[model samples]
Target: MTAPATKPQAAPAALALADDALVLAQRLGEWAGHAPVLEEDVALANIALDLLGQARVLYTLLGDEDELAYLREERAFRNAQLVEQPNGDFAHTIARQLYFSTYHHLLHTQLATTPAPDAATEDTTAPDIRALAAKAAKETAYHREHAELWTLRLGDGTPESHHRMQRAIDTLWRYTGELFQDLDGLQLDLHTLESNWHTAITDTLTQATLTVPESPRTSAWTAGAGRQGLHTETFGRMLAEMQHLHRSHPGASW
Candidate 1:
């Protein structure tokens, strides 16, 4: 007798990566008029646009970008929990940026430098992935530097600012491990990626006079299942807000 066929899963790498960019871009775009200064308002918006551009490229590689981004249910999104996290305050936003941009820069650097496997000739997505990685690496490098500078300013600035920066870093540290977790179709060595990320984060924190949290990044109590479609409570609300207009308009486009 023939066996029953299993359903195919979404392309984990493309979906997850694209979701990461999309979610974070939404979060950053929230700072439009609320940023601490006019300069920060414009800066965050530009960064959000950059991330949105990246997400569009990645989503296009998968299928209908609109359907994948706007039509998907909350549980279907595969973004890392870190990116979906609510941007608490200016310092908290900077902390999230510090952690994610560092990881993003490192991950894209690997993708840009690493040669595609033999199967890439047949896999049309490989070249696009490489090109996106190459382009995004440059963009994320700026993101990393921006985060690093802010982390330093906030962490070392004043007593209140320092305390807030420290608290933000500690609060978000647990969500970071998921960044290094294995994803399908990514051929880079996770060990090296993680090690480099650790060193970079450590150096930045040390320079900022901030302490790296002793808390574990992954554990039963910490978040790690986002790639498996699990997420925090905040994600549902954020998704609703992000998809509201798109879903409401249903194919209406300017």
Candidate 2:
């Protein structure tokens, strides 16, 4: 896609941002035929494709097309710990989609305005970035809706489903903070982004009768350095599988 970094904003620091998208896409693909309902199965598969498409375009922005897709080593990968976390159950997968998509909507929107919200209409790239942002915004809206509907349905339905949903929230909830984390040269205004995200996520959860992870707990949660190429144990396993073919026969291409 050859995404250009906005004039006032620099390009992403690592291909790892794109790596996060790619890994989540792959993990979601695992549920293609196993969702509890037909509509859900279709929805999840489509979301997986959407994430994969974004990843492909983002990777192209970072470097050599073929190499970026498959040539990276495990220690070189840059996806967040949340995306790489195993899809433990149906509840877990749904929670994953919900949380990530909501964050995407907020992050992309904020990035779109980074060039100065007033300058947005005057800049030529603004039109293009705005369109891209609009598309992603719509997709994320649907993703959040689908995920929350599923969460509520499951959480409010049976006793077993309710328990599972809460457990999913507890385990997966901690990983949410890393999404809004801003680092040096990240091209994001961390404080502003964090405030906006807190508002958006809390409002969304409130409607679903869910609580945001308390700040103290989130504070105590360990931060994984996915952005810096540090990864959890399973992440290496995933990278190994994804990179195996390209590594075994470097420079051999179709």
Candidate 3:
């Protein structure tokens, strides 16, 4: 009798997660010396380092961490569009962080509680993913808190600050739907994840005294496609800058 076919491993999910962390780390790192205040520079840098560490673990699972992060072409990355967005103003950055870190924290929490994969019957990557999620959930809790506090401070601040915060929320609202997309390989239910995300975001926004933007109309264009490796126009420029050092130095490393 012919042997049963071996199911392919779920590399896409891992790659997507890795790319999200890696790209966001790079974006956040851009604010290292440029943050609005000295304390924020340190805070943002710490967050970036945490994300970079997560990316390294995820990338190591796939193969060479450096190659996967530095050598990938524009069409090869699988990060969400939200993370790759330009950090506009302080409010804009905080808004993006609030949305993503909340989602991340919730997702990791769920994953940590998920039943372990059957070693004999399922992909081995499941155990690794769960382990990673457990650790990451802790870190993301801090991230979520940081973003939430800032959201409140900016949203309920002076009139000008409030206006900027509200505008930031509205601008980034369109990109958010992409985070809830149902990908093929993830074990978690995307619909459930999205529901939790919405509830959490709504509650936080309400507390911040900020208006949550109306959901996009069915006919309106939503930004996604990153899971399928497509990215925004600005992503190319970001990629160029990120890869420059590695490309220029070749195999050199400190």
User: Which of the numbered candidates is closest to the native, going by highest TM-score?
Assistant: 1
Q: What lDDT tens digits, residue by residue, belong to model 2 across residues 1-254?
A: 45456432323333555677788887877777888888878888888787787676556555565677687676677677788988889988877877787777776666665664555324433344444555666776677778778877876768787777767877777777777665323455777767776686666566656656664324353555666666777877776777787788888768
Output the better candidate (1/3) by lDDT.
Answer: 1
User: Candidate 2 has which clashing residue pairs, if any?
Assistant: none
Between prediction 1 and prediction 2, the one with superior TM-score is 1
TM-score of each: 0.93, 0.80, 0.92
Cα lDDT tens digits, model 3, 1-254, are 12115433756777888899989999999998899999999998999999999888877777878899889899999998889999999999999999899989988898898786566544756567678999999999999999999999999899998999999999888778878765445577677888899899899899989998896711155344788787888999999999999999988878
How do all the candidates rank in terms of lDDT, highest first?
1, 3, 2
Looking at candidate 2, what is the lDDT of residue 106?
Answer: 70
Kindly list the per-residue Cα lDDT of model 1 for residues 1-254, writing each as its tens digit: 11114311325687788999999999999999999999999999999999999999888777778999999998899999999999999999999999999999999999899877667432556556778999999999999999999999999999999999999999999899889888776566899999999999999999999998888887667434899889999999999999999988899888
Q: What's the ranking of the predictions by TM-score, best on top?
A: 1, 3, 2
Clashes of 1: 0
What is the Cα-based TM-score of model 1?
A: 0.93
Q: Which regions of candidate 1 deviate over 4 angstroms?
A: 1-10, 120-122, 222-224
Query: Backbone clash tally for model 3?
Result: 0
